[model samples]
Target: MDEITGVFIQESREQLAEMEAGLLRLEQNPDDQDNINAIFRAAHTIKGGSGVIECHFIEAFTHLVENLLDSLRNGDIAATPLLATLLLECCDQMSSLIDVLAAGTPAPDAGLLARGDALTERLKQFIAAQTKQPEASSAALTVHDSSVEASGGGVVITDSWHISVRFGRNVLRGGMDPLSFIRYLASLGEILGIETVTDAMPAAAEMDPESCYMGFEIRLQTRSSKADIERVFNFVRDECDLRILPPHSNLADYIKHIQELPEDTMRLGEILVRCGALTQAEIDDGLHLQKDLTPEAGLEGEGTDQTPPTPPPPQLGEILVEHKVVHKEIIDAAIVKQAQVSDNKSKEARLVRVQADKLDQLIDLVGELVIAGASANLLAQKSRNGDLVEATSVLSRLVEDIRDSALQLRMVQIGDTFTRFNRLVRDVSKELGKDIELSISGAETELDKTVVEKIGDPLMHLVRNSLDHGIEPAALRLQRGKPATGHVSLNAFHDSGSIVIQISDDGGGLNKDKIHAKAVERGLIQPTQTLTDAEIANLIFEPGFSTVDQVSNLSGRGVGMDVVRRNIQALRGAVDVDSVEGEGATFTIRLPLTLAIIDGFLVGVDKASYVIPLDTVVECIELKNLPTDRNFLNLRGEALPFVRLRELFEVEGEPPPRENIVVVQFAGKRAGIVVDQLMGEFQTVIKPLGAMFRHLRGIGGSTILGSGEVALILDVAALVHAVSQGEEHRLLAPPARHKLSAVQNVRQ
Candidate 1:
């Protein structure tokens, strides 16, 4: 598609978003005029722009939508739940049409067009029914000032409206015929009289046959307001000279239109009088009122002793636009020249829409910069030149700043993702005949855009899991002493340097006995094994593990939560479940702020190096009085579970004489990892591990070192959980003294 078409599609989507949001708002507050105006404006813009680009299919369908809205604004039809639902359906259909156009189709398929036709008929039913009512059956047309004073035989204009229109020369070429507009007007009202202008037509030899040169002056009889009448010519407003004069309009009103028009005031007034708006009788009545309001002293004497109290004298016929009522013409004009106002402090302030591919390229470049900067700094330090090392150090700091700024560009608020579940929960609750409300907080928490995108599906599953299994039916909940209406909530905030998203529900929590039985039945665990409550609660994430007896459309087929766990872990994140038997449950997911680059703490064990996220590193201390074979260390009278990286990765050679314990925290647990050397802070660009390394337990991803070797990035969260679980298991079940001594003797 060409640039123009692409822009149209993009703008069309924006308008659709406005429509959908306004529709939802209307559902909440059905009497909100601002929302009604917003919805109307979105639809009007779509219709007008579609005509400008010659999208006849969209224009035709949107015209019907506009008619329905016209009646709504006129107070002929109340804003009902039925109307909101129908409008929502119309929004969906508009989106489908936009998709067809975005896909380079000139028009929608026949079936799609049929769908539009059906929706149009549904809309027309509302409008047609409205017009057929007793009070709205008659059309009110005011002969516009342009021709009420113009000459026509036996044309006695009643207390009706007058409308004058002169089409632009290109109206015909723009796919709008003057006569068709006339037919639409007739549909709105009965035409009292019509005078067609052909004076712009050239002689036969000089006239361009394809160009239009027609003008129209009609005296219409209708019950519509001035705003409604003006909207009749909304499509061709910018391409025409149009004016509507309400019934009983005086000479001043006619002169206002005349001064604004490209014509003499007197001539315009004569035309209005001819069309019956500025008739002699109205003119006589206005002059009589003008005479009555004058000061009596001015008529009686030049300087009387006292002046009678009367209204101010008449000034010249100068009308400021502010003095006039806000008409549909002004609104149409505003829409035609709409400008966007930017809030200085908004995240979208001064934003330019860039393709996602471009952003991805930028991130890739920033990652490369990070790698090269580290390499340069390493070489500079090795050269042992003071000035060179200092300059490279400065460059490294600036490079780090640039990397941070670049990564910040890809960070987006997680709240937007969380809020999408509102409509989902609404639909699902209604489908299941339950009353549920979803509340959200901490929507401003930001994370890497890529992670945000990939996190959505998993979060969807988690929320649905809460709704399906966590929240009970209304009757059951009431019987269980819970509220009749269930509650689900989403919350997010920054924890240390990571983002924590929680989806929680206030309903019946998991039944540990059922889960345990199911686990035993599925052979996932042995009944004889002892487990903590957390460990038992987490059994739900096991593959193909569910306690539901029957399958339903929502869930119970046992295929979701495990995938949620896997996906979260794939992002180098972790998921934990907490629950009480009858109170509630909360699933927590923790993730890094950005996946592109990070400040990592480097460590060396024997001949290998590893990277641990620097943010999780709490403090570093020397290993003192540590047990040789035990996994726990006594620190400050507290047992700190420590993992020996050398033993875990099976590194070669003996342990170093001096060892370091790097204290780290993850998921509310504290642990230590023992390494041979502390290499301090380093800049690392994250590179994903290959499929072979995906199952490698402690290594999350791999990165290149400044010394030209690959260093594995430690999966701190997973390792912490593993070590904590190990310690818990050991304390729960330890080997017998005789068996342990025998095994030690055999080892020696």
Candidate 2:
């Protein structure tokens, strides 16, 4: 029972998934033949699978759907909007059926079956109506003829045989059209007498058009063999009772045909009588004394005698193919499936379904390797042994390579995530009565899978925000000399070892003055404050900040955009906004390529080691004694703002006699980091400090340094923003007596 239930669940889930995918595609391309075919195939597969597991309810429902889709595929009916809606409902019903199966209970609603029946009848009427039109009728008839012709050449027969078929009581309701099977059988052989049995059917009121209460006793007068007859019912053999008998020339055949079968019959004689080949009285009389002996049950006892008919060993390739139950082409493409199981068996080559936790553990171990390599470097440096130092350097390089490889395993392209938004935009655009087109680019950009997973919701909000607020309605767009269809584009790319995702929409650019006014009204900003467009644009990220006059279903509860910004910031990433009035707005998010270990430049500021993300560091230059403005640095006359970390972190030490500045750039803005010394590149494994220190500024996270000291990794973006803002000048200036300490901390 467990095995049967498992099979049903697995098959039902697969069919449901296929149905969902097909329904989505059908919604997009209602007239697509391939889409229709795919949908029909899913429904057909569900019907067949459900029938085998004796789930008559599902089988019956899906069969009607399959027939309708088949009619659509054959041009017997057009794919009308009503039909599509009905099919979508069918998909929903299938989902409900799966839920019921998962819960190990009867289906929740019988209305689904009724609806399915009504939908089937409506589809049938549509097909009938379509056939009344000459052109559609001709096309459908042509398809039927073609299908018949295609089945003509496959008939293979060796000896005449009789086939008895008793379809299940619910077979009709289960969606199996008895006529189609008869048509298929007739294609296999010449029929002599096909007597339809009606003994099992109940009264008319109890009859179900969707259920099969009929059976057949067939005498096929052809040279076709038993195997040929069996092949006709191959797909439904498990759901029906079938028996085949060889032809004979005797009065015994007539007498055995009249038998009233036992509750459970055995052997060739019983099988023949059950198939109406011979009468019961003849079998009872001919072997009256022998009936008690099991061996006298005719050819059925042959299995116990004559070498016991040794069963053929299954072919390994075939067995594997059956057990995996994948498509034949998939098995053929992988040679492992074809190799002989006995000699080629190797544990290493076999596919194993390992828990994802194991892979994460492996990645964690690789991160440890990086930390260990850093520790070894520290040991070698202190030992002052040239060979040991060289060996440690080599080990460090190897560990760096391993670290990169391990992290790469967690990198996945962002295309699938981006594609999902296409549907979202389509649905939301329709709901808002806006003509919006979503264009995606740079989808092949790769990012850490963990980041990608967490980033989706934020991206979604940004997109919805753009569609709702950023994009103007069709009429407004036309009045503004823009295309009726507004364009929203999602692009992604790698920038300086980080993933940059940009969502831009072509609408009337954000109304800067209106936003400023709204911000002032909400007390978010002072009325007298002067602000740049970028600053005004960023105000949208403030919690409960919205410019919409009235809230609608789409957005503007003032709840979403702020959360989007917060989530992105939590990833140690930055989000920037840009807009050109009437040229659309772009929200760009920059995130580290990986969240684990990274190549960093270790520096000392006031005796504290700080790690700077190496990718953001553009270059290092000596800070010569040339006089300069108090906060500005002359990087060949570039006027870059310099942030002295000694003052920023308030470290106690004297300024180094010679100092260097590490120039870093982000979002096209540059800043200089003043450090006591420049340590060459180090592989730093980022370890997040517990929630206790999450609010710490200047320090993004901590890493273990080579000397086994905790090094704070500098948040370059924050430091750069601080230098740009210059709001902490008085706080940064050190106090006296610490006069040398003040000098060390870059005192005024």
Candidate 3:
């Protein structure tokens, strides 16, 4: 696809999103005229954009949608749930058409064409149902200003648009027939009157047939907007001058239109004449009166007396106001609008559109720079040169700054992703015969764009589960003393250098007994295995574990929850559920703000180095004598479980003397990692592990060190959970009870 087509697809999708959102709002508040107008504008924009790219399939389909929206805006048809749903479905069809365009399909398939035809029929039904208003006769013609003045001060009483156009002299030489444009204009509305001017024509002997000279003053009666009328002359815009004044426009409307004209500036008389607020004859008469008022015209006794100062030519604006031709308020509004437009243009000039891929490429290059800077700093420290060490230190800081700046470029707010679920919830609630509302908060929280992209599907699945399995039916909810309307909420915030997204609902919570029973039936856990309520609640993440007795379309094939867990884990994040027996369940997902790089606490396990995310590290201290039979440590007063890195990775070596415990915390749980040496802080650039080691639970990813050696970054959340689970399992074992007793004695 060409660049223009690519831009159109991206912009068209955004426009469709707005359209969908607006339609949903309109459904909720049928009298929201502003929202209805916004929806119309979005549809019109898509149609215009598609037309520019010659995407006739999209343009044709959207035109039908636009016509229906126009009717809604005109109050011919009221906004109803039925109309909103149909429009939303049309929005979906537009999206599908965009997808086809992106896929390089020449045209929509038979299925899509059929769907379009059905939707078009529905749209026509709504529009054609309105009472048809009769078109006014084209025989009687009136200029614009007279109609307004006839109704007293600056008030327009007729619904007729006045259009004025002057074709360029080179129009014919450029192979464009001026008459063809006028014929096209007539199709948009009835031309009540048209007067052609040949004043610019040279004498017959000097005239050249190819050089054309013609202008038309036309009064049109139509329901189209000024923009719609302006589009007819789009092809000839640069080669002609065009002005359109809408129906029922006051003096201010004409003034504003003159201010927005393509030319930088025009004389007041010409501005008025062009906008159909006045004719050339009226302007000529006004100018003649102004000329007579000039001081030069009032000079007495020709050349003999004292020279009187010649006052500047009476300003045309003043002259018009003096003659009661137009209002001063109109002139003031025009000035204000001109200033506002100029300011807006200046602000718009500062923005530039860059492709997403270019940003990704920049991030990758910055990641490499971070590594190179780390290597340089390492060599500088080794050389034992003070100046070089300081220079490398500054370089490292600058590289760090650059890395941050580059990463920030890809940081986008999560609100857009969250907002998309509103439609999903609305449709699913209807399908399920429930009244559900989705509320979002903390939507301004920003995260890496890459993380946001991959997180959408996982979030979608979780929300669907909440709607399908988590939120109870309205009848059931009310029976349980809950409101009839189920509420689902999406919230996000930054915690400890990571983003925490919580998806919660206010309906039936998870049933631990049902889950536990299902786990046993599925053989996910042994029947005799004792578990806490939290553990039982999380059993929903197990594969093929479903509490539903009957299969339904939305869920109960035992598919979604497990995938939600797996996808979140794949992002080096963790998801867990907490539920009370009667209240709804909440799924908490913790993910790194950015996946590319991090600040890490380096440690040595015998000779193997591992990096712990610095944000999760509480502190480090010597692993003093404790009961050798257990991996728990008494930190202050709490029993912090510890994971020995050498034993976990199976590093083949004898134990190092006087080992240190690096305390790390995740999800409100404390744990310690036993390492031989504390290598201090390092900027860890995350590199993905190979497929062979992807299943390794404790290690998240690997990073290249300053010494040109690879160090595995420890997944703190996974390690914490593993230790906690191990402690739980040990407590259940009879043999470990004696060891735990010994550890308790040592702690005392």
**Candidate number with greatest TM-score:** 3
Q: Which digits, one per residue and each the tens of the lDDT, describe model 1 over residues 1-748?
A: 3776777778888788778778767877888876787788788888887887788888888888888886776567899878988897898888898888778787799999888889988998888898888773232324564545433644344545667788988888889888888888888767988899888888889888778888887888776555567778889877886766565444444333332221122332243344333334333334455566555654654445674455566521112122222233432332222221112224355577777889889988988888888888989999999998999999999998898888888898987687678767876887777888889999998999999999999999998888888889888888899899899999999998999999999878889999998899988888899999999999999999888888878899889989999999999999999998778899999999988799999999998899999999999999866667677778789889878788777688889888999999998899899999999999988999999877777778989887779999999988888777777766666554322231222222
Q: Which is the better candidate, 1 or 3, if ranked by TM-score?
A: 3
Error of 1 at 640 (Å): 1.5
The predictions' CA RMSDs to the true structure, in order, are 14.2, 15.5, 10.9
For each candidate in turn, the TM-score is 0.72, 0.64, 0.77
Q: For candidate 2, which ten residues in a row score worst on lDDT?
A: 138-147
Model 2 stretches astray by more than 4 angstroms: 1-28, 38-71, 80-140, 143-354, 626-629, 725-748
Could you give candidate 3's per-residue lDDT for residues 1-748 as a string of tens digits? Answer: 4999998998888888888888878867899766887788889989988999999999999999999888888677778898889999999999999999999999999999999999999888877776465544553334455453344543333556777788888888888988898898889878878999888888999988898789998888765555577778777777876655555445555665565454234556656666656556557767887778876555575445566456578777687766555567665655565566577777768866789999888888888898999999999999999999999999999999998898888899999899899899999999999899999998999999999999999999999999998888888888999999999999999998889999999878898888888788778889889987878888888887788988998899889888998999999899999887789889999999999988899999877889999999998999877766777977889898887777676689787668999998888888888889999999989999999987777789999998899999988888888787777767776783734432232222
- Tens-digit per-residue lDDT, 1-748, candidate 2: 6577676777677666666656666766877766676677777777877787777777776776777777788766666646666776677777677667667777656775576567667756765776677553321322222113334545223224556678986666566777788888888657767899888889999877677778898877544445566677767765776665555432233332222222232443354335443334323433542433324223554567553754444343344334322223322323332233323445435744344577678788988888888888889989999999999999988888888888887888999788777668766887899988788899888988889989999998999999998899888888988889999999999888788999999987788988899999999888987666777988988899888889998898899988987788778888888998888999999888887878899887765788999999999999878453355655776777777777666678777788899999876788888899997888888988889977676668989876778998887766765565452332333442212322222322
Stronger candidate by TM-score (2 vs 3): 3
The local distance difference test score of each candidate is 0.78, 0.71, 0.82
In model 3, what lDDT does residue 723 have? 81
TM-score ranking from best candidate downward: 3, 1, 2
Q: Give the lDDT of residue 133 in candidate 2.
A: 73
TM-score of model number 3: 0.77
